[model samples]
Target: MSKPKAVVIYSGGMDSFTLLNRVINENYDVYALTFNYGQKHVKEVEVASTVCQTLGVAHKILDISPINQLMQSSSLVGNIEVPEGHYEDDNMKSTVVPNRNMILLSLAIGYAVDIEASKVYYGAHAGDHAIYPDCRPEFVNAMNDVAKIANYEPISIETPYLNSSKGEILKDGLTMNLSYEHTWTCYNGRAKACGKCGACVERLEAFSENQVTDPIEYE
Candidate 1:
């Protein structure tokens, strides 16, 4: 029997990395999609490419850099400095790209429909709710509604980690024996991860919670 097809919204971050591996392990033929939206962390796009190539997973990367001019207030897409602190710190709100996940999910849905794939796997988790409004459960629910009616061929948004914490998501990935070295989490595009950045801090906390060493290098 043929496996079910899925479009995985892969950012090459830990969450999406884990989700991509999990969906592949679940017997889905995966098509990974990475976005190049002029974020400082475009290194993640390169990581996604390498991981997909090594895993023999079909992958597509989209360049949507023109919108960066509209979202200049965001540290992720603009020249602003990324705030360094714990994930829950209010200053970390600077990293929230305006409607990023909405834009990504919309494109992923279009890809899934184009390929006749029934599902689009997203890596949204509870940890992002404190910072990114688009990663909230309410946003997922609303997007699911639009995904259904946006086209005659409905595509389901599957968020297996919707209620899971970052630590829990890491645990699941570790259980699958997936390596985190293939992922990139730092908000900055430095050669080494800045451990003090909010993205690095949250990722380190997840690794600490799992009692596992993060395979990625940091400075």
Candidate 2:
């Protein structure tokens, strides 16, 4: 019997990298889908390509640049600077790309259905719910419903880390010997991660909580 197929909504960030490994570990014939939505985190697209190559998985980069035009308010799409602080800080809301997960998941589900994949996996965790509304549990559930209704085949959204903390997710990835250094999390889209951005701050804190130093470089 063949292994089940899973489509991973990969962003080449710590959380999604961990989720990608988890899906691979579970023996899924994985396909990685990444989006180039003209966000400031363009480096993540390159990182995603590298990570997928390292894992020997088929990867696709979808162009959703129209999102940049639709959601111009976000620091990710506009000249507004990405806020620097902890994930829990309210100012981090500036980084929210409006309905980002919704758009990504919709496209992912369509791809998954075309490929006859049974599941689509994403890495929405508790750590993101504060600022990213689309990462919240309710949004995931609603999107899952939409996927079910939209597809003729049985397809579902799988968010195993939906309620898990970033530390817990990282620990699982570490157990699988996944490399964290290849992942990019900074919103600044620079050569080196700005250590003060909300993404950097949260990732550092997760590593601290896990008692492991992050292998990624930060400026």
Candidate 3:
């Protein structure tokens, strides 16, 4: 019997990389979809490519750089400096690319349909919900509903880490022996990760909680 197919929205971040491995481990014929939306962390696209090549998964990168022009309020794409702090800090809200997940999910779901995949998987975790409305559980539920209605064949959005924290995600990834070093989570897109950014801080804390040293370099 053939395994069911899934299209994963991969970002080359720790969470999404873990999701990719989990999907493959669960026996899904994995397809990775990455979006290049002109975010400050554009280096993640290169990282995504490396991961997909290493994992031998079919990967596609869609250029949606125009969205950056429209959502200039986000520090991810605008001239604003990327905030540095814990994920819970209010300043981190500036990193929220408006409706980012929704836009990505819409494209991913359509790609899933085109490829006849049964599901679209994204790595939105509880840690992000405080700052990103689109990462909330309610948003996932609603997006699943939209996918069901939008697809001719039965298709849905799957967010396994919707309620899981960054720490838990790291633990799971460690169990799978994922190559964390290749993943990029810095918002500044620097040569080395800006260890002070919200993304870097959360990732560091997660690895610490798991009692594992992160393989990535930091400055």
Candidate 4:
């Protein structure tokens, strides 16, 4: 008997990495999808690749770097500097890739329709509400409406951590005994995590809130 099918937007970051595992644990035959949209670094892609391989789940990295041209206003796409601060700070708006979630979810829904997967999973939590408008519940609700009507074959969009904080998401992942070492959250994508960056700081804080070692090195 085949388990149900689902697609996970696995970005190799702590949140998505956790989402990937959560879906698998739910007994879905998971297809892990990663996008190389020309971010500041490929380290997260590299990390996602390794973890997906280790888990023996089907995975693919799509190169949509050409679209980076349209998204250059954000610091994450081109030569702009990645600012360092609290994840909720207004300065971190530089890290926002305009229409990122919409674009990614559109593709993921298409993929799900192709694969006959009934649902698509992603990690968008409460913590992102302040910095990323698309991560908020209203966006998810709106996107969920579209996902069901986007095609003849309806698809469900699942956000398990929608109301949770980063720390809370990490807590669920920890309960699964997942390792954080396989994840990469640094926007800098340097040799070591620039612990000062917004992503890194949030990751570090999550681990702190859980009262556990982050298990990754930082600069």
lDDT (C-alpha, whole model) for all candidates: 0.93, 0.91, 0.92, 0.93
lDDT of 1 by residue, 95-118 (tens): 888888898899999999999999
Deviating ranges (above 4 Å) for candidate 2: none
Q: After superposition, how far is residue 55 of candidate 1 from its true place, in Å?
A: 0.6
What is the Cα-based lDDT of residue 111 in candidate 2? Answer: 94
Overlapping backbone residue pairs in candidate 3 total: 0
Q: Which tens-of-lDDT digit does each residue in 1-219 have in candidate 4?
A: 999999999999999998999999999999999999999867999999999889999999999989999998899997889999998788999999999999999999999999999999999999899999999999999999999998999999999999999999999999999989989999998989999988988988999999999988888
What lDDT would candidate 2 get against the real structure?
Answer: 0.91
Give each model a TM-score. Answer: 0.98, 0.97, 0.98, 0.98
Which pairs of residues have clashing backbones in candidate 1? Answer: none
Model 3, residue 33: distance off in Å is 0.3
Across 1-219, the per-residue lDDT of candidate 2 in tens digits comes to: 998899999998999999998898899999999999998889999999998998799999998887698888899888888888998898888888888888888889889999989899999999988888998999999888888888688689999999999889998888898779899999988989999999898899889998988998888
Report lDDT (Cα) of residue 185, candidate 4: 92
Candidate 4 wrongly placed segments (more than 4 Å): none
- State the RMSD for candidate 3: 0.9
Count steric clashes of candidate 1: 0
In model 2, which range of ten residues has the least summed lDDT?
146-155
Candidate closer to the true structure by TM-score (higher is better), 3 or 4: 4
Give the distance in Å from residue 44's predicted Cα in candidate 4 to where it truly belongs. Answer: 0.5
